[model samples]
Target: MKEDAFCEEGDIVLADASEDVDDIGKAIEIVDIGGQRLVSGLHTILASRIDHRIVVGFGAYLYASSGVRKQIQQRAQGAKVLGISKTQLAEVELAYPTEAREQQKIAHCLSSLDEVIGLESHKLDALKNLKKGLMQQLFPQDVA
Candidate 1:
C-alpha cells in the first residue's frame, strides 16, 4: 500500500458513499493511531491537512457543521446509494478562524461538549429503561 493511503494522527476519513443519504460525507478525525497502520476502506475519502492552518480535530466537526452538511446533502446523488466524488467533496467549502489558537479552542470546546452529550445520552437511556420496568411492574399484563 502507498504511504499516503495510510491514515495517521489528525487525518480525516470521510464517507463519500453510503446507502443512507444522511450519512454521505460524514467524517471522523484520527486523533491517535495507537502504533497501528490504518487505512480508509472503500467508499471513504482520506483527507490530510496539507498545511498547519486547520488544527487537528477540526475537520471532523467542520464537516458536521450545518453549512457543510447542507452542502453535502445538496450535492449527494443517486437513489439507492448516495455518493460524492473527490471534486464534489472539494467543492464543499469550510469557514474557519485564521488563527491556529482559535481553531484549537473551537475543537477543544466541541470535543468537550460531545463528551458531555454522550454521558447525558447514556443517563437518559438508563432513566427510560427504569421507567419501562416500573411501568411493567405497576401494571402487569393480563394472561389469556
Candidate 2:
C-alpha cells in the first residue's frame, strides 16, 4: 500500500471494539507507527479531522476533560465491547476557539507543557537511578 494510505503520526485512534470502553479513545502520536499502515482492529477507528488543531485539541481533551468524556459516554454503547458509531461521534459537540490561529496557539502551549513534563519525568528517573547506584556502592549488603 502507498505510504500516504498509512496512518499519520499524531492521528487519534479509538479502540471502539474493546472489552472495556474505558480504554478507548487513544491519541497516537508516537514515532513507532510513523508511516506505518494500520489494519485498524475490529472496532478501532481512525479519524481525519477537517481542521488539524481542532482534532488535536479535542483528542488531547478526550481523556482529561470530564465534559468531553461525558459526551462520548452518552453516545457509546455495546454490552461486551462498548462502541460509538461514527454518527454518534459526530453528534458530540466540539468546543474550540472560533479562530484556527487560536486553536493552534492553544495546541502549541499544551504541547510545550507536555514536553516539559516528559523532561521532568526523565530527570526524576535519572536521579532515582543515581541514588540507587550510590546506595548499592555504600552498602554492599542489603539494608533490610
Candidate 3:
C-alpha cells in the first residue's frame, strides 16, 4: 500500500518517526480524496498565529507562536490517537483582524506570491526547452 493510504481527511498526522524530522512537525490538510487505504500526494500546510488566532493553510510553511503551543498542550489531555493520547499536535491561537480590508490584503499578498512562483517555474521550463533545441542543432548525432 502507498504511504498515504493510511491518512484520512481532518486527521492530524505525525510524520513517520523513522523519516527525517526537519519538516515533520508541521500539520497538513488533505486536498484530495483517496480510498480508505490509499495515499494521495496533495497536501497543504496548516498554520496559525499565536497573538491573532488566525488559522490559515500555507504552501510549505506552518507557524505557531509559543503561546499557541501552550494552549494546545493544555487542551490535549486525554486526546487519543490510534491508541495513544499525547500532546503531539501543537496549539495555535488565532485572532481575526477587525478590518476585513486588511485581512483581504494579507491573503492577496500570499496569493500573489503563489502566482509569481508559478510564472517563474513556467519560465524555467521554457528556458530548458530552448537550451535543448540549441544543443540538438549544435551537435547533431547520427545513429547507425
Best by TM-score: 1
Clashing pairs in 1: none
Tell me the tens digit of each residue's lDDT in model 3 across 1-144: 655445444333433221232333344444344555534233322232333333233212223334433444344433232111233443334344555466556656766987999999999999999999999998888645
Ranking by lDDT: 1, 2, 3
A best-first ranking of the candidates according to their TM-score comes to 1, 2, 3
> Which candidate do you rate higher for lDDT, 2 or 3?
2
Clashes of 3: 10
Runs in model 1 lying further than 4 Å from the true structure: 142-144
Highest lDDT model number: 1
Q: Tell me the tens digit of each residue's lDDT in model 1 across 11-106.
A: 888899889978898988888789999998998999888676678888788878989988988898989989998888888888888888888999
lDDT of 1: 0.87
Among all windows of 10 consecutive residues in model 1, the one with the lowest summed lDDT is 50-59
Estimate TM-scores for all models. 0.91, 0.68, 0.45
| Superior candidate under TM-score, 2 versus 3 | 2
lDDT, candidate 3, residue 90?
33
